[model samples]
Target: MGSPDPNGRQLDGLGGGISSLSKICVVGPPTRPGVDVEFTFVQVGVKNSDIDYSGNCGNLSSAVGPFAVDSGIFRPLKDSGDVSVRIFNTNTGKVIESTFPVCDGEAVAQGDFAIDGVAGTASKVKLDFMNPGGSKTGGMLPTGNVVDCMDGIRATCVDVGNPSVFVSAEELGIDGTILPDETQNMPRLLERLESIRQKATMMMGMADSPEEVPASIPKICFVSQRNSHMLLSGERLEADSVDVVVRAISVGQPHKALPITTSLSLAVAAKIPGSIVHQHARSGVENKEELVIGHPSGKLVVGAKLDDNGEVERATVYRTARRLMDGIAYWK
Candidate 1:
């Protein structure tokens, strides 16, 4: 994943030179009952050409319905209006229920809902992930603790949507508003954050060694008090509009936009007592279903239905989906 071009470009590969652009979602017919389809998401490294399937992606998952309808890879469903694609993520072994708007048994691509980072708007996809806790290590709080101190850095190791190590930005001398390029320019900080992630990975029982842990299993992020921040595109955000400003590191860089899975994990962690993300969470989260998480690019609202015992029964979020193309590319 290291060999970028002279201008730090993924010029030699199909990758778009960013962490979010190098992903492959392969859909297959369902092998399990009560499921509409099976999807295996692959993260292709920009320069190394390596693939990691340790977790699922919410962005690519949005396109599954349209892909299934156009390719006829789903099934013989005899329904209309809204169709549910019960996706079994092979990497995390979890079920993602994606409901998309369809017209005449085909996915409709016209809608008014819009998501930041994407150029245009399209039909909205409602994704509800069931039993999302402990996506990797089989427990919500992997260390059985909320906050842990490691190498002078405090972090919360949780695995709701994915195994993530959440650290307060103040602890790392950061404000959680910097963009991805700053992360790529600083090696020592990334190393430290990764060290925390690897330690949490082992504590969560996802790996015996941090160095041996898979590239994409346990993600990392820095949290700070909600503040008026600026996005990479030079758009300014108001502090009152978000609950918390988060800088999530994905594939060793700051995410241009928030990962929906991370938002779900943060929402779940916010409900729990004494987690890092919970410390600065917005008020009224106990009574509210959705939470607004401020990211570097923008903000995303995530909702988690909690049972009486505070367990996340199901998590829901809205995302816009669009088809880039509808053909196969021949590879040599």
Candidate 2:
């Protein structure tokens, strides 16, 4: 991916000039036992040269299994039917079990299952994040508290799929349904959120000072109770269809959709009493394992299973991926 381009278009490389589009995944044979493949996720910067490997990408993880099967990194026992791939992410030291359909020794790319953000329907790829707690920091509650006061606002810092800080959008004096373009125009709101995020980063021990914080880790989002809102697609999302509403910031820009890791952390936070997310989420969500989160693009349903100790045992999310291309390029 291109970097250090002031224009930010990344015309010299494969980057799409967006953080989500500027990513790379290196897959290889597993070094550890009981793992089918080991992959490293690289977050390349579009406008800057900062290559961050601080956290895992939930969206990209969905594509690894199919890639493994098609690339022959992990061969399926059956030529046709369902298969599972155990993947170890080097960035987070977590295992993700990817299960999908295969036909004639190739991963199937056509199906009826659909997900938000991406257009059209395709084969469903089920990803079960095993023991996703403490992905980056050392504990689920990295700050040792369910809620911490950051920048004079109450926030819940969680580290399930990734370290995340959640606050109530109502307390921030902003509508929860603000679109990404609208968020870009509010400099002060962005500054305040960055301040809170930096503070949370320090409190979570991800960095010693504000300047040392990586741009990609420690995601921050604001939450609100389920309410009717318009999605980025201009479709109405009813209140009864979702359990909570969230607006997340990624790499200092408003995200078009919720990150999978952030969704995992939010699902975990929703189960914790007294958390800012729990307080703002729809009532009676604690007893339920699945949490439907409404974002700018659409709603995502994530499931979090808690063990006997009430800690997150696993987190589940479904996604769809298809091979865009397969080739090699020269970069200098």
Candidate 3:
């Protein structure tokens, strides 16, 4: 990136000035048993030339299966219908099963499905994060508590698809529904979120000191009960349509849209009895079900499967992907 803007504007490179867009994925023939493709996810810095591989991008992970089939790393399971591709994400050491529609022995790429953040419609790819608990750290609840207080902050340190520190935006003197500029431009507010995130990583044993903690993994989210929210783009979110409001900090700024991997953690956190997400999330969430997440971009629905003990069995979400300019571009 070589660009330095607190707003995450990567003027010097290919980054889209956001965390969701500054990414790279390398897929190859699987080396493990029962896996079709193996991948390592790279998160390029939006403001600098640094890259971190400590986590996975759920949005980009959706494209791995189609990439494998199109690249000849895998083949269609049948002549038609749906083909499921097993992926091993090296970053998290977790296996994800991606099911894509098949047509004439090739992965389908066109359909009527659409998602927030990205424009246009494409073929629906169902990504099921198999046993998605504890992508980093160790157990699902790394701190061994659904809710814990640290530095006078009430937060939940859970590890589902990724490790994240979930805190109440109200505790931080905000409602958790503001837009990127409104919150990202405030140094004090951004500091508070980063401080909580560093503390969370330390508390979860992912890092010994705050300085050692990276900004990508162990993501941070400021949440509040559903309310009227005005986006930075001048859009309004009524109360009834959304169960909760979320303002997630990605890399260093407010995420234009919530990260797909973070949504897995959020779904599991919402299912927990006392996590911050559960406190504000709507009730009647059954095991192996879906949780609708409200973010700055729009609403995203995620699937969660919990055991009888309420442990995260799996987390799933639907996404769309297309191969744009597949040929490589040389960079100096």
Candidate 4:
């Protein structure tokens, strides 16, 4: 193993190939009945020295509940139940609570549930997005419009749990579900999406320019008719294709599994009037509380409760989070 970088170059011994690895942690108390969130994302990649705390990791977000429960950030319940962690994200000034399944008075990790990009099955991790929209730009539609055309792609830019730019699969010459190899083969298509994302970020007011931006939040996704099984990195999701095409971007690439927050954003965008997502979504009434979003891995069920004024009252979903390991990561 390499020695830890004196200038904070290496992060926990993992090669910081991507620009998203620079970070430090200091957990503290929440103003409410949960673990308070206080963490910062630093610049790892020399190319882009900007850290964005506006968005939480949909992947790493799963581990927050377990981290809190086991670390005594919160007292574990006496029975298998929910443990909530109030995330005080530095980037967006937002507090999000991620809930997980606790079994035997300990956080649960074993189950038949599976998420793409991860091997094997684990317990379900659920995240309750408290006012998920506008985590970053202060509005669900950052552009002040539900839908817009960027780089020749019509998209619905909504900030739910995370900022997302939603488009249809057909625009990208896809049916919404393509094999990983097939997608990898289309480097040109991927490159085009990058351009779209860069512009969308500016429209969302996340960056002044795309020159040195790190492709993180305000992810780009495509939607299409749900497939009975969508093959991702060679894995198959056994759910039928939903009405609209759904694809989401994460960390500058197509997320192996759809982001939970982005899923919420998609659900919200699909509801708003004049939004492109609303025009092509599968059979469901507008502002429906429960909407199942079909992803490349499996179908993620999202519930959106709307207020009488037609604004989203609250959006909820079921997910399982487990701690993989807790040890000092050595870097050089």
Highest-TM-score candidate? 2
Top-down TM-score ranking: 2, 3, 1, 4
Candidate 3 residue-wise lDDT, 94-135, digit = tens: 999999887787778899998866678989999999988888
Clashing pairs in 2: none
Cα lDDT of model 2 by residue, 201-229, tens digit: 99999999999998998899999888898
Give residue 171's error in model 4 in angstroms: 2.7
Rank by lDDT, descending?
A: 2, 3, 1, 4
lDDT of each: 0.80, 0.93, 0.83, 0.65
Candidate 1 per-residue lDDT, tens place, 1-332, comes to 33343444666555677768878898988899988888899887765656888888888888876788767887437545778888888888889898887777778789888887777778889999898987877888888888888778888887777788889888898757888888778899999988888887887888887667877767798988778878877999888998877888888777888777888888888887778888877766656778888886687889998788666788998887766676655444
RMSD after CA superposition, every candidate: 2.2, 0.9, 2.0, 4.3
Better of 1 and 2 by lDDT: 2
lDDT of 4 by residue, 194-243 (tens): 88888988888888898755556767787775556645555565444354
Off by over 4 Å in 4: 1-12, 15-26, 31-37, 40-54, 76-81, 101-105, 111-120, 227-230, 233-243, 285-287
- Sum up the clashes in candidate 3: 0
Candidate 4, after superposition: displacement of residue 332 in Å?
1.3
Candidate with more favorable, higher lDDT: 1 or 3:
3
Residue 215 Cα positional deviation in candidate 4, in Å, after optimal superposition? 1.7
